[model samples]
Target: MSLTRSQVESIAHLARLDISEAELPVYADSLSKILSFVEQLSAADTSSVEPMAHPLDGESQRLRADEVSETDRHEKYQANAPSVTDALYLVPRVIE
Candidate 1:
């Protein structure tokens, strides 16, 4: 699929990118090639393929045990705050 200069400009605007006149054609060609590659991938058959959670079978990701490791110091910390209510810090409202 070939992309025109105007399409490239629209893409740039949507992506919040600043593209110069000299780079517009280059970007358009590159984006067109990417879209073509995706189209080719879509044409491949994968009806028998099994979905995988991870590449390695029987190998699960290890995670640290969830446990409380610190003592509560809310009263000590709240003393330093300019304003706090019910263990929550109070901030000035900037919005109307």
Candidate 2:
């Protein structure tokens, strides 16, 4: 799971990342350690574990009732438009 300096450079190129000569070895070591940790996690046993939608499955989420809190003011705002029709703003056509 360890990554080489050349592999890190290739990854940086594919991801469009700018890595200086001094930082390439640092990035390579960090990426190699991360891959090793992921490999270690993949070796765990989870066959008896049940899938869950939420961590707090017994608790119910309290939500506020959906209601209109603001009045419609389209007519007042449309008064400033240079051109409008049927509550819709008119714009110049750019394409044929």
Choose the strongest candidate by TM-score: 1
lDDT of 1 by residue, 65-84 (tens): 79987799999989999999
Measured against the true structure, the TM-scores of the candidates, in listed sequence, are 0.46, 0.45
Global lDDT scores for all candidate models? 0.91, 0.91
- For every candidate in turn, the CA RMSD to the true structure comes to 8.3, 9.6
For candidate 2, write residues 1-96 as lDDT tens digits. Answer: 889999999999999999999999999999998998888766779889887778798787777789888799999999999999999999999788
**Clash numbers, per candidate:** 0, 0
TM-score of 1: 0.46
Clash pairs detected, candidate 1: none
